[model samples]
Target chain A: MTALLVSVIAAATPLLLAALGALLVEKVAVLNLGVEGMMLMGAIAGFAVAHSTGNLPLALLAAIAAGMALALLFAVLTLTLQANQTASGLALTIFGRGFSALVGAGYVGIAAPTLPRIAIPGLSDLPFVGPVLFGHDPLVYFALALVGAVAWFLYRTHAGLILRAIGDQHDAAHVLGYKVVRIRYAVVLFGGAMAGLAGAYMSLSYTPLWTQDMIAGRGWVALALVTFAAWRPFWVMIGAWLFGGIMYLALYMQALGVPVPTALLSALPYLGTIFVLVLISRDARRIRLHRPAMLGRPFSAGG
Target chain B: MLSLSPRGTASEFWRYAAPLLALALTALITGAIFAFMGRPPLLTVTTFLVTPLLAPGGWEALLVKAAPLVLMAVGLSIAYRANVWNIGAEGQYTLGALAAGGLALALPDAPGWAIYPALMLAGLLGGVAYASLVAWLRTSFNANEILTSLMLAYVAQYLLVYLVTGPWRDPDGFGFPQTALFSDAASGPRLVEGSNLHLGLIIAPLIALAAWLVLNRSVLGFQFRVFGQAPRAARFAGFNENRLIWLAMAISGGLAGLAGMFEVTGTQGQLTINLGPGYGFTAIIVGFLGRLNPLGVVPAGLLLALTYLGGDAAQMNLGLSSAITGIFQGILLFCLLGSDVLITHRLRWRVRA
Candidate 1:
C-alpha cells in the first residue's frame, strides 16, 4: 500500500507542476493549448542534454530554455501577430511533436540517468508516509514548494495584483500604466519554464527513459485541471491528486483481478476530466469564482 | 513607438498571397531538413511534391483520400460558419464507422443492395448522435465545446480499440487488432473497375454543391454567415442561436459520419484500430484552406491529399519516417494561418527615431 502511494505521488508530480504553470498563464488571460507539445520538447531536450553532458541541472536548465523558446514563438504568433489561439496552439503541438521526433531520432531506447532521491533525515524515518513523501527526489519537493510560492505570489504580492488586474481587464490595467503586454510575456514564459520542468521530471526522475510521444496528452489534462480547480492554486493541487488518484485506481483495479480491459481503464482519467468539466460548467457561477474576466480574449491597447 | 497604419488594397494582395508564399518557405525549410538528414534535398522534394501522383494507381488513391476530406470539410464549414468549433468530428467519424460496422457485422448474410444503404444510414445517424453531445453541452450547459469535443474524441477512440480487440475481433483470423473483412453487401459500390475509388467520390461533389446552395441560396445559410461574422447582430436580428447551433452540428456530424462510413466500406473493407487517420482533424485545415467555400474545398482537399500521397512516396523512396507527412501538414497549416494575417491586417514599417 505504501509502495502504491509512492507511485501515485510520483505520477502526480509532473501533472501538479504543469497544472501550476497553466494556472499562472490563465491568470494572465492567455489560453495556451500547446502545453503537450512544450512538455514533449522539454522531455526530449532534458533527456538529450543529460545524456550528453552528464549534468542534471544543466539538462533541466536546457529543458526550461527550450520550453521558454517555444512559448516565445507562441507569444509572437498569438500575442503580437494576433493569430487564432486555438489553431496556433494546435500547430505548436504538432510542430513540437515532429521536431522532437526529429531531434530524438538517434536517442531512441537510450537509458536516462536516474535522479537521486533526497531523503529527509527525520521525516524519512516515519513508518508509512515518510517514503511516500519526504523520501522522494528533489523534484517532488520542488513541486510542492512551487505550489506554496505560487499561491503566495498570486495572493500576497503587488505584482500578482497587477497581473490579476490585467487578466480581469486588460484595457483597464493598461490605462493605469501596468504594462500589460510585458507582464503577460513574463508570466507566459514563467509558465513555459514550469511546464518544461514538468517535462524534465518525466525524463529525468519519473520514467527515467525516453520514448516517442511519451507526454501523450498530459498537457491537455493540465489545461483541464486549471478549469477544474477554478483557477485556484490550492485547488490545482487537489485537481492533480484527484486525476492521479483516478489513474492509480485504474492500475489498482487491474491488479485486483478485475476483468475490465486495460485500455478502458487507462481511459478512466480522461473520462473523469470530461465529467469534472461538465460539473464545473453546470455551475456557471462557480466557473467565475476565480476565473479572470478577460480570459481567452486577446488584449489590444486603446481598443 | 509604432502605430496602426492599415496597408492599402494592393498590399492586401500580398496578404492573400501569404499562404502561397508560406508554402514556398516551408518547402525551403523542409528541403534543409532533408539535406541535414544526409539525403539529396531536390530528390526528396520531388518525391514529396511530385512523385506520388506519377504512380499508376496514384490518382485513384488521391481521389479516395480526398473523398472523406471533402465530405468532412463541407460539413465542418457549416459549423465553422456558425462559429461553432466542433473539434470532435474525428470522434463522430469513428462512431459512424463503429455504427456502420456493427450493422454490417450483425447482418452478415444480407443482400448487398439492402445492406449498403442501411450501413450508410447507420453511419450518418452515428455521426449526428455523437455530434449532438457537443451541441447539447454547449447549449444546455454552456460548456466549452472545444474541450468537450476533443476529450470525447479520446473516449471514442478507446471505445473503438476496445471493440476491435474484444467483441468485434475477427473469429477466423489469427490474433490481430481488426474486425472481419467487410462483405460485398456492406461495401460501397465501386466507381471504377480495378480502382479503390468508390461512390463516395461521386457523392462528394454533389454534397459540396448542395452545401454551396444551402450557404448561398438558403435563409438558414444567411443566418449562419451573420452568426459567424457577428453574433450580436445575429441575436439582434432575432436569429435562434440554439436552433442554428443544433442544425450546424447535426449537418456537420451527419456528413462526417458519411465520410467514416465510406472510408470503412470503400477503402479499408474492415473496421480496424487505425480507422481514423486524423482525417477529421485535417479537415479543419482543409476547411480553412478552402476558405470554407464548399466548391473551393474540392481543390484544397485534393491538394492536401497530394501531400499524403507524396509523403508516403518520400518515406518509401528517401527512407524517411512516416511522420514526415505530419510535419508537412503542420507546416502547411502553420503557413496558411500565418499568411491569413493579410486578410484583415497588413504589416507596416515604422521609422524609429
Candidate 2:
C-alpha cells in the first residue's frame, strides 16, 4: 500500500506541476495549448543536459529554458502576429514534438542519472504514513508545495487579482491601464517554465531515461486537468493525484492478473478525461463561474 | 516601431500570394535546418523536394500516398468550413479500418467486387458512428469537441493496439501482432499492371469534385459558410447549430473512414497498427493549405504527399532522420499561419510620437 502510494505521488507530481502552470495561463486568459509539445522539448532538453553534465539542477534549468523558448514563439505569433490561438498552439505542439524527436535522436538508449530521494530526518522513519508522506524525491514535494503557493498567490495576492481580472474582462483590464499583452507574455512564459519543470521531472526523476516522445500524453492530460479542476489550484492538485492513482492502478491491476484489457487500462486516463469533461460541462453555472471569460480571444491595444 | 494596420479590405493580390510566400519561407527555414545538421542544403532540398518525382516508381508511390491524404483532407475542409473542428479524423480513420478489416476477416471467401463495396460502406459507417459520439457530447453536454475528439483518437489507437495484439493476431504468423493477410479478393483494384496506384486515385478527385459542388452550389454549404463566418447571424437565420455540428462531423468522419478503408484494402492489404503515420492529422494541414476548399485540397494533398516521399528518400540517401519530415511539416504550418496576417493587415512604419 505504501509502495503504491509513493508510486502514485511520483507519477502525479509532473501533472500537478504542469496543471498548475496551465492554471496560471488560464488566469491570464491566454490559452497555450502547446503544453504537450513544450513538455516533450523539456523532456529531451532535460535528458540531454543531465546526461552530459550529470547535474540535475542544471538539467532542470535547461528544460525550463527550452519550454519558455517555445512559449515565447507561441506568444509572438498569437500576441504580435495576431494569429489564431488554436492554430498557433497546435503548430507549437507539432513543432515541439518534431523538434524534440530530432534532437533526442542522438540521446536514445542512454540512462539518465536518477534524482536522489530525500527522506525527512525523523518523520520519514514513522510507521505506515512515513514513506508515503515524508519520503519522496524533491520534485514531488516541490509540486505539492507549488499547489499551495499557487492557491495563495491566485486568491490572496493583488497581482493574482489583476491576472484574473484580465481573464474576466480583457478590455476592461486594458481600460484600467494594465499592460495586458505584457502581463500575458510573462504569465505564458511562467506556464512554459512550469510545464518544462514537469517535463524535466518525467525524464530526470520519474523514468530516468531519454526516449523519443517521452512525456507521451501527460501534457494533454495536464491541460484537461485544468478544466477538470474548474481552473482552481487546489482542485487541480486533487485531480492530478486522482489521475496518478488511476494510472498506477492500471499497472497494479495487471500485476495481480486481473484479466482487464491492457489497452483499455492504458486508455483510462483519456476516457476518464472525456467523461469528467461531460460531467463538469453539464453544470453550466459552475463552468460560467470558473472558465476564463476570454480564454482564447486575442487582445490588441490598437484594436 | 513597426505596426500592422488593417486595410479597409485585404489586398486581393496577397490573398493568392501569401500561400506562395509561406511556401518559400518554409523552404528557406527547412534548408537552414539542413545546413545546421551538416547536410548540404541544396542537395538535401533537392532530395526532399525534387528528387522523388524524378526517381523511378516515384509518381506511382506519390499517388498511392496522396490518395488517402486527399480523401481525408476533402472531408476535413468541409468540417473546418462549418467551423466544426474534428481533430479526431485519425481516430475515425482507425475505426473505419477496423470495421472494414473485421468484415474482410469475417468473409474471407467472398468475391472481390462484392466484399469491397461492403467494406467501404462499413468503413464509412464506422467513422460516422465514432465521430457522432463527439457530436453527441458537444451538442448534449456542451463539451468541447476539440479536446473530446482528440481524446477519442487516443482511445481508438489503443483499441487498434488491442485488436492487433490480441483477438486479431494471426495464428499462422509466429506471435506477430497482426491479422492474417487479407485475401486478394478483398484488395483495392489496381490502376496499372504491377503498380501501387489503386482506385483511391480515381475516387479522391471524384469526391473533391462532388465536395466542391456541394460547398459552392448548395444551400447546406451556404449554411456552413454562415455558421463559420458569423455564429450569431447563423442563429438569427434559424440554422440549427447542433444539426450543423452533426452534419459536419458525419461528412468528415465518413470520408476519413473511407480513406482508412482504402488504405487497408487498397494499400497495406491488411489491417495493422502501422496503417498510418497520421494521415488524419496531416490532412488538417492539407485542409488549411488548400484554404478550406475541396478543389484546392488536391494540390495541397499532393504537396504534402511529396514531403513523405521526399522524407523517405532523404532518410535513405542523405542519412537524415525520418523526423526531418515532421519538422518540415511543422515549419510549413507555422509559415502558413503566420502568412495569414497578410490577409487582413499589412506591415507599416510610423514616426515616433
Candidate 3:
C-alpha cells in the first residue's frame, strides 16, 4: 500500500506542477498550449545538465531556463506581435519537440542524475505513514507547497486579483491603467518555469532518463486537468492524483498479467484523458464560469 | 528601442513578403545551429537545401511526399478557416490506414479494379468515423476538440501499434512488427516509371483545386469564413453551429484518411508501424504556410517535403543528427508565425519607454 502511494505521488508530481503553471496562465487569460513542448525542452535540458554536471540544482535551473525561454517566445508572439495565441502556442510545442530531440540525441540512453530524497531523520523513520508522507524527494514537497502558495496568491492577494481581473476582462483591466501585456508576460514566464520544474522532475527523479517524447501526452493530459479541476489550484492537485492513479492502474493491471493487450493498456491514459474531459466539459455552465473569458483569444495592446 | 504600433489596415505587401522573410530567417537560424553542431555551416545548409533536388529522382520523391501532405492540408485549411481546430489529422490518418489495410488483407483474391475503389472508399469512411467522434463530443458535450482529438491521436497510434505488433505481424517475415507485403494488386498504378509516385500525386492537386473552388466560391465556404472571423455574428446569421463543426471535422478527417491510404498503397506497399512519418503534423505547417489557401498548399507542401528529404540527406552526408529535420521544421514554423506579425502590425522606432 505504501509502495502504491509512493508510485502515485511520483506520477502525480509532474502533472500537478504542469497543471498548476497552466492554471496561473489561464487565470491571466493567456493560454499557452506549448506546455508539452516546453516540458520536452526542459526535460532535455535538465537531463543533459544533470547527466554532465552531476549537480541536480544546476540541472533544475537549466530546465527552468529552457522552459522560460520558450514561454518568452510565446509571449513575444502572442502578446507583443499580437499573433494568434493558438498558432503561436502550437508553434512553441512543435519547436520544443524538434529542438529537444535534436539536442537530446546525444543524451539518449543515459541515466539521469537522480534527485535526492530528503530523509527527515526521525520523522522519515516512522512506519507506514512516514514513507507515504515524508519519504518523497524535495520536488514532491515543493509541489504540495506550491499548491498552497498558488491558492493563497490567487485568492488572498491584490496582484492575484488584478491577474484574475485581466482574465475576466482584459479591456477593462487596460482601461483601469493596468499593464495587461506586461502582467501576462510575467505570468507566462512563471508558467514556463513550473513546466520546466515538472520536466526536470521527470528526467531527474520520476523515470530518471532522457528519451524522445518521454513526456508523451502527459502535457496534454495536464491541459485536460486544468479543465477537470475547473481551473482551480487545489483541484488541480486532486485531478493530477486521480489521473496519476488512472495512468498507473493500466500498468499495474498489465503487471498482474491481466488478459488485456499491452498496447491497449498503454493507451489507457490517453483514452482516460478524453473521458475525463468529456465529464468535466459536459456541464456547460460550470465551464463557462471557470474558463477565462479571453482564453485562446489574442490580446493586442495596439487596439 | 524598437516597438510595434497597430496599422489601420493590414500591410498588403507583408502579407506576400512574410513567407519570404520567414524562409530567409529560417535558413539563417538553422545555419547557425549547424555551425554550433560542429558542421561546416554553409556547406551543410547548402546540402540540406540543394542536395535533395540534385539527387536523382528527387523531384519524383518530392511529389511522393507532397501529394499526401497537400491533400490533408487542403482539408485542414478548410477546417481552420471555419475555426475548427482539428489537429488530430494524424490519428484520422492512422484509422484510414487501418481500415484500408484491413480491407486489403481480407480480399486477397479480389480483382484489382474492385480492390482499388474499395480500399479508397474504406479509407475515406474510416477517417470520417474517427473524426465524427471528435465532432460529436464537441457538439454535444461541449468538449474541447483540441484536447479530445489529440488524445484520440494517441489512442489511434496505440491501436495501430497493437495491430502491427500483435495481430498483424507478418507471418512469413522473421518476427518483424509489420504486416505481409500487400499483394501486387494492392500497389496502385505507379505514375513515374522509376519512382514511387502514384495516382495520388495527380489526385491530391486536383482535390486541392476542387477545394479551392469550394472554399472561394461556395456559400458553405462563406459560412466557414464568417464563423471563424466572428462566432457571435455567425450565430446571429442563423448558421447551424453544430452542423458546421461536424462538416469541418468530416472534411479534414476524410482527407487525412485518404492521404493515409495513399501512403500505404503508393509508398509503403503494406501497413507498418512506421506508416505515419508525421505527415499529419507536417500538413499543419503546410496549411499555415500556404496562408490556409487550398491553392497555395501545393507549393507549400513541396517546400515542406523538401525539408524531409533535406533531413535525410543531411543525416547521411553530414553525419549530423537526423533530428536536424525536425529542428529545421520547428524553427521554420516559428519564423513563419513571427513574421506573420508584420502583416497586421508595423514596426516603429520608439526612443523612450
Candidate 4:
C-alpha cells in the first residue's frame, strides 16, 4: 500500500504539472495540443543537458526553455498567424518527435543523474503518509505548489480575472481594453514552461533515463485531464491522481497475480481516461459548465 | 519594383504553391541535417528521395506500401470532409488484421481462391465492427470520437500484444512474439512472382475509384460535404448528423482494416506485435497532403512510402540515424502547413510612417 502511494505520486507529478500548464493555456482561450511535443523535447533536452553538465537545476532550466521555445513556435503559427489550432498542435507533435530524435540521436540509451529527494523534517517522519507526501523530490513539491498557485491566480488575482474574461469572450474582452493578445501570449508561454518542467521531471526525476518517445502520450493524457477536471485547478489535481492511481493499480494488479490479460492491464489507464471522458461528456451541462467560450478559436485583434 | 499589395494575383499562386514550396523547403532543411551528420547532402538526398524509386524492386515495394495508405486515406477523407476526426484508424487497422488472422487460422486447409476473398471480407467486417463502437458512443452518449477512437487504438494494440505473446505464439518456432507462418493459401497472392506486390495493390486503385464515385456522384457524399462545410446548413437541408457520423466512421474504419489485412497477408505473412509502425497515423498526413482526393492519394501514398524506404537506406549507407527520416517528414509537413498560410491571406510589405 505504501509503495503504491509512492508510485502514484510519482506518476501523478508529470501529469499534474502538464495539466496545470494546460489549465493556464485553456484559461487564456488557447488550446495548444503541442503539449506532447513540448514535453518530448523537454525530456530529450533535460536528459541531454543533465547528462553533460551533471547539474540538475541547470538541466531543468534548459528543459523549460526548450519547451517554451517550442511553445513559441506554436504561438507564432496558431496565435499570430491564426492557423488551425488542432492541425498546428498535431504538427507540433510530429515536429517535436522528429526534432528530438534528430537532435538527440547521439544521446540515445544514455542515463542522467537522479534528482535528489528533499525531506520535510517532521512530516517526513510520519509513517506512510509522510514518506509519500512529505518525503519527495523538489519537483514533486513544486508540482503540488503549482496547483495552489494556479488556483490562487485564476480565482484570486485581478490578472486571473482578466485572463478568464478573455477566454470567456475574446471580442468582448478586447472591447473592454484587456490586451487579450498579450495576456494570451503570457499565459501560453507560462503553460509551455510548466509543460517543459513536467517533461524535465520525467527524465531527471521520475525515470532518470532517456529513451526515444519517452513521454509516450502523457501530453495527450494531460490534455484529457484538463477536460476531465472541467478546467479547474483543484479538479485537475484530482484527475491527475486518479489517472496516476489507475496506472499504479494496473501495475500492482499485475504483480498480485490478478489474472488479467497483460495487454488489457497495460491499456487500463488509457481505457480509464476514455471512460472518464465519456462519463463527463454525457452530462452536457457538466461538460459545458466551465468551458471558455472562445477555446480552440483563434483571436485576431482587428479582424 | 512591384509594390507589394495585400491582394495580388501572385499571392494566389503562392497560396496554391505552398504545398509544393514546402516540399522544396523541406529538402533544403534536410540537406542541412545531412551535412550536420557528416553525410554528403547531395548523396543523402538522392538516397532519401530518388534512390528508393530507382532500386530494382522499388516500384513493387512502393505499390505494396501505397495500397494500405491509399485505401485508408480515401476512407478518412470522407470523415475529414464531414468534419469528423477519426484518429483511431490505427486501432481499426489492428482489429482488421486480428479478424483476418483469426479467419486464416480457422481455415488453414481452405482452397487458395476462396481463402483470400474470405480473409478480405473478414477484414472489412472487423473494421466496421470496431468503428461502430465510436459511432455508438458518439450518437448514444455524445462522447468525443477522437478520444474514444485513440483510446481504442491502444486497446487494439494491447490485444495484438496479448495474442502474439500468448495463445498465437507459434508452436513449432522458437519463442518469439509472432504467430505461425501462414500457409500459401492464407497469404495474399503476389501480383508479380519476384516481388511483395500483391492483389491489394490492385484493390487500392479500385477502392479509390469507388471512393471517387461516392464522393463525387452520390447523394451521401453531397450530404457529407454539406455537413462538413456548414453543419447548420446541413441540418436545415434535413441531413441527419448522426447518420453522417456513422457513415464517415464506418468508411474510415473499413479502409484502415483493409490496410491491416493486406499488411498481414501480403507482407508480414503472420500476425505479430508492432505490425504497424505508425502507418495509420502517418496516413493522416497523407490524407491531408493529398487534399483529401482519392485519386491524389496514389501519389501521396507513394511519396510517404519513399520516405520509409529512403529512411532505411540512409540508416544503412550514410550512417544517418533512422530518426533523420522522421525529421524530414516533420519538416515537410511543417513547411506544407506554413505554406498553406498563403491560401487565405496575402503577405504584404507595409511601410511604417
Q: Which candidate's lDDT is highest?
A: 3
Report the Cα lDDT for residue B262, model 4.
Answer: 91
**Pick by DockQ: which candidate is best?**
3
lDDT of 3 by residue, B14-105 (tens): 87788889989999998898888687889998899899999988998889999889999999999999999999999999999899998888
Error of 4 at A161 (Å): 1.7
Task: Assess every candidate by TM-score.
Answer: 0.94, 0.97, 0.98, 0.95
Cα lDDT tens digits for candidate 3, A1-303: 898988888899999999999999999988888999999999999999998899989999999999999999999888887777888888888888888988898999968679998977898889987898789899899998999999999999998899999999998899999999899999999999999989999989988899998999788888899999998999999999998898789889999999989999999998888888999899999999888898876776656
DockQ (0 to 1) for model 4: 0.66
Q: In each prediction, how many residue pairs overlap at the backbone (N, C-alpha, C within less than 3 A)?
A: 0, 0, 0, 0
DockQ of each: 0.62, 0.78, 0.86, 0.66
Candidate 4 wrong stretches, greater than 4 Å = B1-16
- Residue B211 of model 3: what lDDT? 94
Off by over 4 Å in 2: B351-353
TM-score of chain A of each: 0.96, 0.97, 0.97, 0.97
Top-down TM-score ranking: 3, 2, 4, 1
| Alpha-carbon local distance difference test for all models | 0.85, 0.89, 0.90, 0.85
**Mind giving the per-residue lDDT tens digits that candidate 2 earns over B127-237?**
999999999999999888888988999899999989988899888879887899888888857889677777879999999999999998999999999998899999999
Per-residue alpha-carbon lDDT of candidate 1 for residues B145-187, written as tens digits (9 for 90 to 100): 8788888888888899999999999988797989998888688
Better of 3 and 4 by DockQ: 3
